[model samples]
Target: MKKLTLLFIAFIAILSFTACTEDDGFTFTAKPDPEGISFMNQTADTYTLTSANANNLAERFVWNEVDFDVQTPINYELQGAAEESFSSYSVLGDVTDNNLAVSIGSMLDLAEEAGLDNDPETEAPNTGNIYFRVRAYVGADAGNVVEQTSNILTVSVTLPEATEDAVELKRELYLVGDATAAGWNPDNNNTPIFRDAENDDIYYFEGRFAGGDGVEGFKLIESLGNWQPQWGINEGAATSSDILGGDPQAFPVSDDAFYSFTLNAADGTYTFESIDASSAPTYSAMGIIGTATTGDDSGWNQDIDFTQSTFNPHIWYINGIEIFEGEAKIRADNDWTDSWGDDTFLSGQGNNNNDPNIVVTPGTYNVWFNDLDGRYLFIPQVSE
Candidate 1:
């Protein structure tokens, strides 16, 4: 009888649980807030993107907080895309707050992708419009959650040309003065410094230099017969360290040693490091050969002999030579025994008679070749 009574009590409990919500005393239900998400910040019609201020703040997007009538956390995101399109939008930022800040660098990347540039040579328009908007969603799955989007805004962007104060890096530089074979004469067929193919502001040269005895120094000139834009350090000391330039004064050689040199035209600075060349090979003779040079036979049968540098046994140069539009190679003894050609056409090793021929453009040029590293350069006499 006690078991029957217990079973009866359990049956009543089960009925109560089944009928719980239908006759419950009270309940709570979530409702969407009518005050939807929207932008609350003033925006400009146009903005400029520049490398100088790349890291600086460009814009701050502010929006009103969104409520889905829930106590849980809310997620916010800022998006950008080509004007009027979100098919390929980029999430510029995501945060819990109602505001997000963006940098000029980020916008610059977008402008580049939009085919906008500051270069005058390009046909791309410097000014173009991009779209931006903010989104508020309640949960991770924005599609199934109470999601609201802010009004899309258009922003005109412009990439201004480099400023007037920007430094101009010339395409070529020449070594001259008492420490070099040119001996202070600008027109003496000075050795050409190799300009970096990837970076116009950087230059490099490695060869023999004389004079650490205090009086010998050198300077760089842009053209063979011109010296007004000369570059050299003010101090005449010879030692390896950081260097300053811009003055017509001479940079000291520091010692009668083989040195590797670098100059940064953008910052008016240079460096001279004395390097050991004991392991470097010196060829008996090297000259320009291939279709780029000329003789009666023309193409590969001709050779333009290069003058061996008196300062270094492994360095050779040819001044004011017309390098025709063809392929060229620097070889030893008028033959291909030891030949150098680089795909970059800037520098590389001979690699056992294997390498790509140096591409040439027709121009009157001063050519310098370093047998030590198989580096070569061709500098035009006149700007083209």
Candidate 2:
């Protein structure tokens, strides 16, 4: 009787354990949020886009979060398309956050895509409408998953007329001399002066001019190695010049200082204005870090160091470096104290504000960064 009773108890215990295990399994039925996701704020009737404030925030789209009635993570995406079109929608952003910030430059780009242009001669309208909406889904979209889409919203954009005084720069200028980072070697992959966005004929750079005992001057070259169209000071004092042919006198520099150089190719004039650095901040290093660069783990785990210009501490570069497929950002001193991730232009602002990361394709590139104005350049190198 004891043996039979013991077997009965053991069988009962096993059945109870099995029942508890089944009961502990977590599962829930998914139902769409009672309050469907939609834009919480109304968009402005019409937005005016201007290049003057290209880096400024154009809009911040916000929406109500959806409760999918499940424990799985839900994803959000902002979609944009031409008015009255649901297909061919472009992803403005793919983020988990409920809000996404768009810059004025992005709005201008979308305006151009909508066939709006500032050119008066073109038949394309200077104003148009863009449609936007929010999409929410869970897990990888394999076509079987049910997704929620918010009601499409409309926003109009207008581009101002271009100024008639705009001048196009035909020539590219490079720096060569001991006073610059390339030093006396004109073939050291010399740095090119940045051109003004509005006025292409105007070029500028802010850097240190380390004066030496001999040849303590700098000159602008038209191209690498070939210095026929070189520029220097001859007719006037070192403060300004109006000559640009047959190797003019090198601009004189007696002491090392932070100088802001500006050249107006339109009028063939230039200036070197010294800046006092008694209170200005100095950085020991700067670098690029992200999924695009090869780090220890190839994410944000490490940074790919960039060589700071010996002449201009504000300038940083990495020549002929292979960048992987992903996005990245520029930060200072191996720290996040200052960083730039804006992806508006090749030579554009690097606003440290919570901007988007710099997206890049897989290719070898010559990367350049200017800390002064938060401008960056990524030029694809020709495969040899």
Q: Mind giving the per-residue lDDT tens digits that candidate 2 earns over 209-299? A: 8775775688887657866556677676321221221356888877778778888654457888887755655678888888888633456
- The residue pairs in collision within model 1 are 177-184, 238-254
lDDT of 1 by residue, 161-212 (tens): 6543332223467888888878889998678777765555577888877767
Q: Specify the poorest-scoring 10-residue window by lDDT in model 1.
A: 237-246
Q: Per-prediction RMSD in angstroms?
A: 15.1, 23.0
Whole-model lDDT, model 1: 0.72
Task: Tell me how many residue pairs clash in candidate 1.
Answer: 2
> Model 2: which residue pairs collide?
none
- TM of each candidate vs. truth: 0.50, 0.47
| Positional deviation of residue 376's Cα in model 1 after best superposition, in angstroms | 1.0
- Candidate 2's C-alpha runs over 4 A off are 1-172, 197-199, 212-216, 234-245, 294-301, 310-312, 324-326, 359-362
Q: Tell me the deviation in Å of residue 223 in model 2.
A: 2.9
